[model samples]
Target: MQGAQRNSLRLLQWMMAASLALPIALFVFTSTISYTSTKDIADREIERTLDVAHEHALKVFETIDRSLAELNEVVRGLPDEIIRSREPALHRRLKRLTDALPQLKSAWIFDANGKSLVNSLASPPQDLSFADRDYFYAHVDQNIGTFVGAALTPRPPYQGARFFGMSRRRETDDGSFIGVIQASVLPEYFESFYARIGSDPGSFFAMGRTDGVVLTHFPRLDRDFRLDPTGPVGQQIAAHPEHGLITIAWPSDGIERRVGYRRVAEYPIYVSAGLETSAIRARWLATMGQHLVFGIPATALLFLLLALAFRRTQHLHAEATARREAEEALKHSQRLEALGQLTGGVAHDFNNLLTVIRASVDLLNRPQLSEERRQRYINAIADAVARAAKLTSQLLAFARRQTLKPEVFDVGERMQSLHDMLATLLGPAIEIGIRLPAQPCLVKADAGQFETALINMATNARDAMQGKGRITFAVQAAATIPDTLVHVSGSHDLAGGDGLVSVAVSDTGIGIPAARLGRIFEPFFTTKQVGQGTGLGLSQVFGFARQSGGEVTVESEVGQGSTFSLYLPRVPTDLLPQRQAPNTAPAVAGSGMSVLLVEDNIELANFAADGLTELGYSITLVDNATDALAELTMDAERFDVVFSDVVMPGMTGLDLAQAIRDRGIRVPIVLTTGYSQALSQDGAAGFDLVQKPYSIEELSRVLHRAARLRPVRDGAAE
Candidate 1:
């Protein structure tokens, strides 16, 4: 099932990836095609505009050519003197023709000797010499049919606008060149027509001679200019003399454009129309933007749907995984339940023995008993009870049900204080060594439990060496547990918070077998001869380490030695100073010190009330926290201290204590329980706590401490 789910997840991921990639690929392909198409349209439009300019230029040139031919015919055989005499009639005819053609500025007739004979501008025109003019010299020599000249301003007194000359050679019947009949073509004529046609912005129309001499241009220049004969446009004109298209920058302005050129038929002039490349691209972008405006959202919506499908597939995969884990957990729990039942039965039998011993001890307290025998019985009973309590405490710790009172303390300081005690326990035969780090290593946990775990490991080490080997306790700050150590039982995730503090207890003794390490943490599992070891020591260490958010690890080599290391979450040393546990001595209940005792167990409550009453505490007994809270509510000052059990049905002691305080009652609260997960996890909520099966002296001390914390009133202690 897992393999199939994984395959399905992979398939969904691929589908989602393809869903996004395919649309982007298609959008890019379409955009590319659109760009090429738009450019083609732009190219064709430029060609068409060029053709229009060509036709307009052709008709104007043809009319000018025809007029020039007519003038040449009229003067075909006439001498200069005869033509000069008929100047008035000729001038009137030329004026009429010039007036009819808006493009014509003026017409002139020049003698071969470079003298102006008769001209259209004025009848009996000014006798300006044509010797220096280029048009007269061209006709005077070889016949260059319809010679077009470079752009020139008319001489002063005859100036209207810039124009270029178009001329035809005049000759007698012998076909020898006599003079020239020339027409002045106005540049503004084409520029005005170009404006009326409404061409795109930055586009231009131009007319030029074949030799790269610019004749006229729309959007005319401030000064006269010529095209480079070697440039792209000029080269195209030479290569494709009739017509062609080219994309090139205008030499005059360097603005790149798509230009189309046409050579005017039977004339030396060429006309071109151009559209700027920037403008063409603008058109293409506008089209592509429209496509994106619609296409992008559609693609995004498709992606969103695919994302939803992928999320659903992931959820299904998680459900399958959870089902598998649940089945495995159920099986594991069944195994744990079997083990728990065995342990519970043993604990039950042990408790019955303790009860019988306790009743016997109570009966022996009769008044008629002899002093010597009674003292001996009293000492024996005390020893047996202490041993039983310690055994039960070990069992609870191994089960992780002990109600721990955790506090922050310096590990190095605590370890230092244990040196003398450890020396006394191990005897002079076993050498003891203590190692500490230079810096203080602080940890938050039950300081008493931590010491007990250390002492348990040390005692085991002592027994392994038969009471004649060295034992070393090393404390230091650690980043993580060493991987080389065997993780017997407990969490392996020991590195957390600020880091970890490791307390390693090493022994020079016969090491434990590798096969036995795994089962060492099990309750009641032992390696020594019968009755020599309880096997609950390492188990208690394991439970304490796990409950403290840490772990215990061991490293050993058979016949050599073993090292047991305890790892606990480190507290920042700079955090508020370690709280010092106050020195507690056996306390006697004060006279008139009223305590509200809340307990659900009837027999236990009665025993506690009687015990405390004998110690001079005015005890008020209640079965549950509700009644205790009600008693406090009715008379807030009735009890100097509210002593309650932490674990109870309906309302827990912790809740009742909070309730009494929440109601503005100043009674001090002291809690007791065999084991409360609530107290272990979040502590006693600032209330004093006492462990179950506590002695009257211990109970009195806790109650006295709590009562002292009550608010003083009337300038006296409450």
Candidate 2:
């Protein structure tokens, strides 16, 4: 059962871990795939935007080149002097061309001496020197097909705005350069077109010369800017001169971007469009945030449910364990109850038979029967009765119904006496060792039962050793009983004080197996083979310890040995009673005294009445307490003492005694029983109690003592 519960808990823990980990793993995986796909989409969009910008740049430059071609054709065969003479007509034609195209700022023709002979800005061209201009110098050497220059502010009329020029070199039939025809293109033309095309935030658009000169940019630069010759975009363009895409930081502001570039066809220029890398990241983050908004709660709820299930399983496991323990306790209680009933009944019946035999034996022990054979028969019968009494005592002890006479005694002194007795009983092959405390260890328990328990433990140990090992008895002051034993005993209420005295019996024997340790205290449970053991030794010890308000603990290892320790509630040394030496004098006979004898069994009643008659007691026999009560009520002064058996049919001896006291009867009552539950629970109840199967001599002394305890009556006054 415990194994299954643990497995269930382990499975839940694994599921909890998986529930959280799998979702996060999937979310991260899906987010990664989405990011890559989104970036690919962004790259394609950049390429498309760059394609539109590239087309625009190509058309504008081609138009500017065509105007230059037309201007060159007008002066194809004209001499330098004729071109100067036809300047007014050429200026009118250039003005018409500039008006037709919104992208073109103006058109110009430069003479070989670097004089601007014709211009579109003014009817008579300004005195701008073509000798210092880049276009004029380039045409002087060789005819480079359509040369696109760096952005610059044009002279006068086109000033305050930046422009780049497209120029063509004019040559004679000999292919020698003579002059230049140039057209100025406005940077605002591409910037306005880029705005119209509609780009995202943080997007860039630019056109630049292949020589790394930036011509025009949307969201224009504060000052003229150029791409570095050795930078990322510059290297990208050099590697793929026609068209390609690259992600790089803009040299102007260091903002990372995904850029697409294309080289305009047959022109020394490139166009690019880009969107910032931060914008792509923003798109990805927004998508992932949406996933988290839904995913996090689902994971949390799964964890919460798993946590609840784990707690619920633990609760159920606890309840199951509690229920199992309860059932076990109930079964044990029932077993003890049944044993008590059986033992009490058997002991009660057996004691009556022993009483009859004892009475017969006492009759034979008279001095007149001086024959050796008759004396031997009486001695043998007496021995048998004593042995039978011991047997019944063991049964009553195991049933936990034995009468206990508790007295505060020193444990160390008691063990010292047992050390010698056990040594002889266990034989020469066994050794007995004794360990005593320096100070007296005092306990309140039945001294006879205590010795019996120790003897039982020692005998078991002797058998375990096969009568060939060492047995040790020790006494000590303990703070409390061991927690393990406390739980095993389940007698927490017995451990009352901080002071506990431990009397431990240890043996170096073969030891008990672990599998059998827990059942060793159960009645009829023994490791010995049949007929060799009664199996009630340890159970008797267990019941005796519990009935004495203490607990017994056993510790054993298979090959090492076993220790049986009794933990009894300690008493103060001051509570110990003064020891009295045993009196060796013969039993005193009774004078003519009256005894009201209450017995349910007629044979046993006759036997007791005859025995007491021989002891010089005047007996009034009654079979039940009711008859005795009626006799006492009729003549309260007849008997001096009531010697009633404790167990009878209608009313018990204890109840009769109470009735006598309640009726104000002045007689002393003496109760006797073999085994009575009432006697066990309520004790002697201020009445003197003698166990059954008593010797006639002992019965004489008890009747005499009870008669002595009676109150003297004022018969003269009555």
Candidate 3:
């Protein structure tokens, strides 16, 4: 009987080993197969992603082409004489064309002579004399009905920005070649399209021209990665343009990822999609785990029954662990992706507000102003200008555009300066209250930006209450977010040990609706009526807080008004000196300097010339830079100053200045334009700039300043 028991035990051991070995081998084999399958699935998904990107890109291109075609058709219908002679009618048509297509940065028609007849933008070049331009020679043929030009940096009349061009030939009724109607699409429009491509956090999409010039990339990678296409991954893509997938170690994240790519058949563009290998592995593991979850118990039961026949529990545990890890990774990727989108939207809107404010302030410094009214105007202008500057600093902070400029300052004192202004801004209906710490609570921040952000928030609160509710500006230091925030009532939590400084603005107005509350910080998305708001207020607050290594939170109910809290990182530091106010405007007395004023706007030009003449300066007016240059060449020292519109026909103001300088004509040049920022970053160096919509006194002041600063030789000649 003992020998029988021993034999049975040996048999059981053998059965268990056999069952375990077979299933263990099978699990390994199955997991390997699953990994392979997941890789294949990922490749297919990436291919689909590329196809969608291409389709969307083509749609964008087609829409632009259609708009260009319609514009060309309109120009083609007009009589040759009307098209050539009627500048007003042509301007109206061009304006309509551009207004209908905001994505088009600028549109213009070049006559057979290469002269720009009409332009959507201010002051286009008048002469087609420059033979080097693509449109100049291309339009001379007039046989090309429609053609997409190479990616080229646009010149004046086309906004002098980087743009992709679409051009079509315009002809007379007799089929005679007339000119070319060209449209330059802005880069922002393309960037917007790229933004929509890859929604997944682990996924990145890039589109590059056949020449390997990257047109756009989603979730913009580092600039170095964008610039050097000759890197390992770029080399791989260059070697294989057809549909393919390859595993590569991504330098940015230090992770191995599978990149899939496809080149559009007829277009010189390639679309590439990148997916993290770990993500794919995780997905496969989760799927395999789900199967193992159901298969495990059944397999165990089978082992129990088979143990009489075989015996073992194998395979399940290892598979389950891998699957769980994969599921966790996917969840993490999704969370990060959602967060990125939220931050990106906030940044984009904040930038737009900065753009508007910067442009608006630059327009305020025009030369013409009477001494009597200058101080009052200058004071009001300075207030507006300061607000604009603060807006940009906040954006830079939010975008992490610059290093933090932290300083210790009393929030109470800062709020005091703006108390009266806020009251006036909110109007008589809204009651304002300020709550401050008894002892000055020192906090760190770029003082100017911090103050601006506070003012912006208070202004928004007042607006929300519709000028009828009570608004409170409160500040304190806290170790923790107070639970009883509602009843805090101007309390300060001192000795909280270096915590954040909390600035809260609360209003007793109608609360934000739940749906729109999430998007209040998006640029150009205002709840206010058109023209009343640019929809950047909350966005600035949000960006400023984040940029300062701080956070902003909002809470609101349907009926109760909303409260916005900004928690700025605090530190002990000395406060910076306050900004001193500039004195009232200097006297505007024009020196009897002869000025050559070149402008294309006939009425505006005449008005400006009249205004300048009234200011005691002799003015020589020309419709375009060509005639101005002609008159200047006729007499080098003919004028003390050359004032030209930056955007004009034949030669742009910048080009005209260059030409004059080339001839060693050092007449002090002043370039003026409504769209000054779009011209050039440095502007016309060595020359002064005066933005448009200038009053007579402002013009005289510019002339006076220019005359005063003239070179010794030029001043002696004048």
Candidate 4:
């Protein structure tokens, strides 16, 4: 009886093992099948989205091209007298053509002297000059029949609107150029076309011009969404004009999305469509859920049957315990990871607030606070604010929250600026050396962030050396590595081509240990004393480099020093000239006649009104557009300029300007905002824009200069 029981127990154990193993094996197979099927579906969907977006983009190009061609034909048919004449009949005929063509916002015939001859809209008296216009020169010099001008917000004829001009040279029967017939298409037409192209819910579609500025987008387009072709997405599109798609998992939302892009051949524009991966996985999840629903009951039934048939089942409990422990470990690691990310985000936002407060406080004592005792107290407060701001900036750097405004700048120039400060920081015990090329070796990065990173690294080096060491800063063009060459360091080989810049910072100190090197970039993982380091220096540098579309790598050994190399992508030659120092405020101006002030911030508005009044300009203050329009209708000529905030309660500043223009009120409109680039193109166009948090000097200058100007016809309109 005992022998029989032992054999039966062994058999029961084997049967129980198979039961658990079979379901797990089947689960793996099902998951693989589901993943493969889902990926296939996603690929097909992405391709379809790209195809639809491209088709819509092409249609826009064709519609504009055809409309311009028709306008050119009409101009060709007209006699030279009729074309050059500003007769009401001629204007009526052109107006009819413009009205008949829905896409054509306005049609005009301009003689060689750039005067509006038979404009579809109101004809301004002055003879316009086209010699300066890009489209005009392209038609005149290059003799390109169909010249499409850049996206322009039409100023005059149809003020406070956005349009792009399409021009064609009008030739006489003798084949000699007589004049240029131009048609303007409203951007709304393009925007509408994109909207009709159809988009998935929770998905976004965007079209970017050749310059990397977003032309249109489904839903709303944020100010920062504009084409910055040098950005990561822009660079990808530029480099790969063919079918390209990228999948990114948003860390903030925990949502994955796939962005698929295709270039439209007719124009230098790329149409992109995105689909949320979570949405795509919904069906798969549902199916899996159903499977699990059935699986649970089936699994329970199998367990009950085994317990009834077998006298003992000790092995099952041991296996279950092991699985639970493994799961627990994974959960623990994930919790830690999440906590770190949350800490970083909090640090970043706090830093930005500190920066604003510090800057504001510092500005308070600028006009000589050194004399008065109270002024000295205020200065002390400002100093404390500055220190707090610096601490926040460091936290933000560690958290990767600070905004990076990058531009192409010479590494040598940047290094030179920091040399003295770095030397002072290191003390007499350490030596600092910089080796940079005489010629500008430009890298695209935010100067402030880069400087901060360098200083942090230098500080780390100082600490490692125990306040004595030699630090070297060097920059050069990265060596071109052939595609076929094998790299032993596991680093991605730098692509061979022009326009690559590299920055290297090396320190002669007790180097990092091999074991600790990998952990160096982990926040709060410091080797220093509790009070000495927050353990975020290397991490900040890593984040800054990565955010700038660059890579940072370290080379170190136990005894030798450490070398950190930053590889930043090069700016194109054409873009290099456009690069300038980032300015906090607009250049200041001195005097003006009359001004309209629209600000919701009561204190800021009062301050501005006082400042403008002091600057010899009469100021009309209104809280919102309703009051401004009521005032404007009462006396349009009373105001020389319209100064308004962008984000107001009821009618936006743009809407108010549009309303004023609709009522035939023409004045130089200046729009100001704390978040300057956040305004849409339609809202920002036609008026001069000034970013806010402005000094009195900046506000005065903008108003004075803008007030001095009268409404002039845009060259592109002609």
Candidate 5:
């Protein structure tokens, strides 16, 4: 049955994949064909456009040819004397022809001796000699068909208009040359005509004679336009002769163009038109786009539908099983990896702290140590021990199984105490704000976790803003449960109240993006650059909140900044067991005072007791708090001070102190621990507290201050 089900799931997946992919594949294949067809159509259209323009260009040549042919007819019929008479009717007819063809600048009749006959002008300005002109000189044996001169600017009739002069030799009936009839064609006429036709900006239309002598062109109206017959485009035209289409890099702009050239059989002129390749490609893409616009989305929707169906039917079961296996493997691996890194980071910091302690302790052993130097070393040791204790405190705060000690305390007062430390932590660039409640807003949470979370948030805010921004720590109590928190949780340990305490850390800094907000609390996931972060800070905060039966939520907008709010259950301050004020009295002499020391580590107990004994105190060492309690119970007045480690297998030092006080004993109990959430509270604060790995001097001072001095062990007290 399982095998059949798995086969069905596999078939469903395959069917879904085929559902989306088959059509897309078909579209791709058909689209390729469609695109190719469109491109071909574009090429043909481009060719047709070039051909039409080329035909238009050739028509201009035909007009000039007809005009020349009419002039030939006049020369063949009219006698030299009649034409030379410069008859008004004949001159008007010549001017009418010139006016009809805008390309023709003028038509003139010049005798073989270069004397003007009928120059087509209503009035002659000056006598222009054309005896030196190429057309007049080309008359060889009276057999020259038609002569086209190079570009020239003639006087009067032609004015300053540049054109190629077309001339035909005039002869008498005996086949003797008589005069020359010439017409001027200004290229500007072609330039103006081609401008109205739709073509690419860089495209050109040209009319030239068979001998590679260009007569006129659309562009470069200021000069002659010609093409070399041996060039690629010219060769293509020459090879085809009647009409030719070839793509080539046009010489004028060096852009590839599809050139269409047609040779005019009636007029010894070839008309060539050029269209840029870029214009053709643009047309092709536009055509291809029309087909793809609808096809792509249809494919995507099919894909989405198939994915949803697969996820609903078969993927959920497989995924859940695979996810469980992967999560288990990944969790075990990540725990080991993160633990290793945490251990290394902790050890490195501890090494520095340990070095200070070691150096101070080694120096204190010097026989010739100065009193001032000795004091400095002792101070150094104490400072190192305090720093090391805080480091461990951070570690314990993040420990997975460490039971949180939830207590009710004023949130504002707690934050106010950390203000200076936070300021130093964030640096001078960041401003700190404390928006505390007017009245005490007591919340049930591990105070140490609260402090860590606050510090972590401030640090993150500082980093987000690159150390320059405002961070506000605010606390408030609510009268009702937040509507946003929809579910009532079973682990909700907030002091049974109408609402929870909201402790917020807001910063005017760079905010988190919505997509990354959810994963920010995941361990070993950080946006910070390598070597800049351990990635456990936010995870620790998250763990603290959940473990304490509270919840942390954040609100942020990019550029506007971010706010992290921790909601803890509120409790009445009056309900908390009141603690005595901390003892701040100065240290007294420990000389000859009897001290009972309880430490689980036998070596540590021996060392500490020996130092206390050497300091002129009677020392009684015990391995556990139970033993010390029994000893104290037996003879409570014998010892002046009870110094014990806060952590043990059973009956912690704090428990012993509570037990001692509960039993009506008045022994000044001094406890030593690296870090204990229990000892970090209001009740424990009244007892003299000292961090472990302390030098003899620190130990002496705390014990002296904590001592409820009885008669000296030597029995010499006044």
Candidate 6:
């Protein structure tokens, strides 16, 4: 429970973090959008203010410029006498001109000597030399076109007042130097016009020239006409082009603003407008706070809900995993119980066979034994040994490790051979049925495993029927089908279609349950009482069928009994030609052919040696293949045949046989083994082979055949 809670908490933490993070990210995005939109709106408002300021400032300059032009034209016709005399008409014209132009403070003319000829506002002092003025030198030297001068203080009547001048040069008819016609406007005129636009509450406007000269500026500076380019506002304007918006602190006032400036066309004046920088930033901050107010709480609520859902899901998954593990543990315990039952059954069967052999040996040990009694004792021991071999073979088959010797044989023939054995195994009470197809069901597999599997199925059928029902062992060729486990629902011809060979053992007795049918082939799974069955009979059948490249299937209903079918893959008819069973008749004689008998067991060696001598063969005995090889090496031509027993300790009999041939010795060689593995391809190669526990007659025949056979040539049978 502690582990579960910890995992739940970890999952909830991650989920909550994800949910909250999403909304916070959205909040950031909303703030960014608001900041962008606010900046754009502020820029548009500033641009509009600049437009209005530019129009009014341009209008004021145009009005002043027009009046100057009109004055220049009117004074052009004045003859030489008007300048010589202090004329009343000129005086009246200058005073009336000053009264008509609202912005103009003075209108005057100056002669070639730089003396004031007449004044618009009042009379000027005769001793005042205007030559020192830059405007005077400007008109005297270049005597053409109108010139607008820098702001300056007027002398005498207009004293202590600053104004910017506009002047036109007066020339003779020959284009020679004459006099100047000039007008001036008070700086108050531009300042009053700038104050009216109201672009921003704390905005400033200025008029300047590119040459660092200031005509006039609103909110006036204390400096002279030469504007300071080194100042912040001045530096910003100088670095930019005619008209653009820039953020700069006004050096004259130290107020930061977004300023817009434009140069007037064909005039010495540049007009600039600006708005306070603090106002724009303040408006943007207000918008961002509105988004944050609603967003944070809603995000937290969503994160809590997601964390709860994740914690619930984790609890369900933990319960499901624990349930599955418990089921597997129960299965393991059941299998262990079955294993104990199987071992006890095997021990009981072997003990019975050992008891019979022991009883037979005791009877054979009496000194005065009759011939018929001696034969009976010998027969009992032989029968017990055969039963032991069968028991061990079945156990190996159940384990699926038995060596399989495959051969092409008719299934019908094999079933016919098991007729008497199956009848005796099932007892007299249970009747048997044998079925075979008209055509042969030829297959390649281990014949011994196949026969054992058949007997095992018969025994199982007898048990299912309580030893009183009919048992049928049938052989038939199956129809072509993709799946190995085929359901036979219709009739199939045995001769026409070539497919698998199926051998089925069926019973007309109590049927198996559908649940039990699937598990009948599993080792130690039986319905019988524990001591009555080892449960390996059906398992042996299953292992044999599969290991031989075949399949086993069961079909049953509640009361219709069961049919267990073993399906083996069919072989090509000509792959292995059928061989007739060799005659097991006793050998009549040996033609005195020399034989070297290599047998490891002392009792078996003496028996074989005595038997071979009686059969008239020259016999020699050795305990092992190593000693046999040494004996042959001392006199290579002494033995005509090397009969070695397979499966010795140091060197196997097959190894000795191969070594003799490797040295090019031409004597015939044969091998024998008690185990099935010795009959495999490697053991049976380049020599004749015979199974163990052979009779004296059987050994004699094999030895005679080995000596008669031609020597092996080039590692192959001749």
Query: For each candidate, what TM-score against the reference?
Result: 0.56, 0.52, 0.34, 0.40, 0.44, 0.58
- Residue 73 local lDDT, model 4: 67
Candidates ranked, most accurate by lDDT first: 1, 2, 6, 5, 4, 3
Predicted candidate 2 versus true structure: per-residue lDDT over 1-718, tens digit per residue: 7799889989998888999989989998999998998799888888888888888888887878777888888889788878778888988899999999999888888766766778888867776675666656766777678888778776654465777778888778998776788888889988999988746876788888888888888768878888887888878887888988888888877788888888899898888898889998888888899999999999999999999998898899899889989998998897897577456645655676577677767768667775875767677677768767776777778777977777888899988877678888889999888899999988887888888888899999999999898988888998877766523344557754648898888999987777777678866666788558767778788888888778888888888998889888888778777879975555556567878888888998899888878767788888988889899889878788888899888788899999999999888888888999987777898888888878677777777777887778757363
Q: Candidate 3 at residue 665, lDDT?
A: 79
* lDDT per residue (tens digit) for residues 416-511 in model 6: 888998878889999989989897778988888888788888889898898898988888887653354433322233232347888888898788
Candidates, ranked, TM-score: 6, 1, 2, 5, 4, 3
**Considering every candidate listed, which one attains the maximal TM-score?**
6
Model 1 agreement with the true structure over 1-718: per-residue lDDT tens digits: 8889989989988888888889889988988899899889988888878888889999999988999988888888889999899889988888888899999998888888877787778877876786667777878877888888877778856767888888989876777878899998898998999877736876788888888888777777787778888877778788889988888888877888888888899888889898888988888889988988988898888888988998998997898799889988986885596478447745664676677577668868777988887777777667667767777777777777787877788899999998999999899999998999999998989888898898899988999999998999999899988777788884455546799999999999999998888777887676778657767788889988988889999999988999999999998877646466877677675688988889899999999899888888898899988888778778867778888888899999888988877888777788888778787668777777788778888988888877887778545654
After superposition, the stretches of candidate 2 with alpha carbons farther than 4 Å from their true spots are 1-374, 484-491, 495-498, 716-718
Residue pairs clashing, model 1: none
For candidate 6, give the lDDT.
0.75
Off by over 4 Å in 4: 1-370, 384-406, 479-497, 513-540, 572-694, 698-718
- Looking at model 4, which ten-residue stretch has the lowest summed lDDT? 481-490
Q: Residue pairs in steric clash, candidate 4?
A: 212-227, 213-227, 214-227, 589-701
Clashing pairs for model 6 are: none
Question: What local distance difference test score does each model get?
Answer: 0.83, 0.82, 0.69, 0.69, 0.74, 0.75
Q: For model 1, how big is the CA root-mean-square deviation?
A: 13.9
Clash counts for all predictions: 0, 2, 19, 4, 0, 0
Task: For candidate 4, give the lDDT of residue 86.
Answer: 40
Q: What global local distance difference test value does model 4 have?
A: 0.69
Question: How big is the RMSD of model 6?
Answer: 9.7
